[model samples]
Target: MNQGAPNRVVAAQLNIPRGTVGWWRSEDRKVRGEAYEQPTDCPQCTGREFDDVAYAYLLGLYLGDGHIISKRSQHHLSIFCNATQIGLISMAEEAMRKVMPLPTVTRRHKPGCVEVKSYTKHWCCMFPQHGPGKKHERKIALESWQQAIVDAHPWEFVRGLVHSDGCRITNWTIRLVGGERKRYGYPRYFFTNVSSDIRDLYTDTLDKLGVEWTHCTRHGNPYNISVARKASVALMDAHVGPKY
Candidate 1:
């Protein structure tokens, strides 16, 4: 079974019943005090080296739009992506695999989006911020080790956040230029989140990268972080252009 063969295949090969094979395996696991325990390669639990760059990016995605379900029988990390952005979906899946390849990753289609899930309870170990209630309703803070990872891969983290809950848009205005009407376009990036803690984390990373941003109100809510400065937008363009 460890070689990816099902019990039925092992039983047939051994000329034994499937139930008997399963029972023998169960008894062996009980003897080893590992009943119902699944093997994992989690960096946190195993103290194994992993891709910190991918982890930093995934951390941003989790803070932005990801969540973990840690129920008795259900455990997984889910990151919702727009169905139109195939690149983002692929990147999200790759990041999850790079961080922990043992978990099974799958995508489920929703009304207009795709939910990418990694089935494993060890996600809670990686993301200690998981708790009850919505993310915006609870305090979200990264542990020291996670902060170190984000610090090392700030651009990747910012890119993940932008891919999840941020967007780049261009606004144009017609102005009189030397007695002629001319149109000018301004391209800006916005990171919107209801959680102040998450927004603060994004801005803090931006500050470290020397990216200027301001709080912008939209539809009577001041939950938007605007990066409209020419140099800052250029930096963002180089690192994260848009969700695609």
Candidate 2:
């Protein structure tokens, strides 16, 4: 019955009465505390093909600043974006839909941000990293399958992480060149997260991409990764430009 076979069919296969099969199935469901769960197109659960690029990006977002709620009654995957960044919000929603189109996606406006959410319990299956406490307080590591996806689409994953908790900024300095004071601007990218594991993931991907970066300390805490090399900045500009 769980495999979508009718009670009569299952009973015939098991050589049992249809009524007995139905009763046993009902009891099993009751014991499992499972209601009639809607069928899901989750790639993990259904073994269906999904948008790998979108999944990689969404995975980065999930590890950076997004989260999943898997309560019995309320289940959703949410990625919060600054209210001012309408493009980022739209991209986040698009990524969610591309990965799993069946679930309904919605946005909730908060004080200074918008929460892009997809309603479904299957998100927990998609993102097994979802846990009970703060991400930085626990061990956060990618599964083998997820790492494969990230390796295949490293730029998209980096873009997603940057869009969530990273930024591109420019700093300038004045110098005397040919007796004239000129200002030169340096553009760099920074990914700041309290999770050391997440920072490692970001740096590991950067290493694969040949992007040079360094650890930055803020307020005496080394939770920031900076990409300031000229070549690295150019690479980032080409692939993961500033989040709009």
Candidate 3:
């Protein structure tokens, strides 16, 4: 009996006659195929091709917090970002739509972050820097066309990188001007990563944007580049604003 022990099964074990108890099983019960139909699995993605801004953003996102998982015919590209970075999620989904149009991607909540993943067959072709271990341990070099894309739309690329692995925060410190002490607060961007190559790509883009950044890392801190000068921060604000 489905619910532990139904009356019919109990009666049968007790030697009660089927017709006497009126609990015999029905002969009209349907067989497996007759009663249910098999459901088809959904396709991962259909769209193909690429865009300079979108692909550059995706590349940056991949270099930061994204990775690919491949199956026989379906390879998934997933990027993780803070939930507050809804704008980045939008950009990522839009990029996925442009690059791999068929199967759609979705944003899922994961603890303090959100994950966006889509099934595609062209992930490896897009991210040639992908390899067996952590990105820091692997050599990451962009192709000529990939470099051209980043050069053309460096802001979107930096935005993707910042949203995934960097952050924008208010940094305040007290400075002594003559005799008076004053508190100064400013918005600064910090991009921290393990791979020097990835960090170099970020710095190169910042250089093209005319934003100055310095390598800043102390104990327990990751390798980072910080853009904190007022003019440089303003330049970055104009080009790539903070993630939502």
> Of the candidates shown, which would achieve the greatest TM-score relative to the real structure?
1
RMSD of each: 3.4, 8.0, 12.6
Question: Candidate 2 regions off by >4 Å?
Answer: 1-35
**Compared to the true structure, candidate 1 yields what TM-score?**
0.90
TM-score of each: 0.90, 0.85, 0.75
What lDDT does candidate 2 reach at residue 217?
95
Global lDDT of model 3: 0.77
lDDT of each: 0.93, 0.92, 0.77
Pairs clashing in candidate 1? Answer: none
The CA lDDT at 215 in model 3 is 88
lDDT of candidate 2 over 1-244, digit per residue (tens): 6886656678889999999988888899999998865657788889999999999999988888799998979999999999999899999999999999888799999999999999899999999888999999999999999999999999999999998989999989999999999999999999999999999999999999999999989889999999999999999999999888
Tens digit of lDDT per residue, candidate 1, span 132-226? 99999999898999999999999999998998899999989999999999999999999999999999999999999999999999899989999
Between prediction 2 and prediction 3, the one with superior lDDT is 2
Cα misplacement distance, residue 244 of candidate 3 (Å): 1.2
Residue 87 local lDDT, model 3: 82
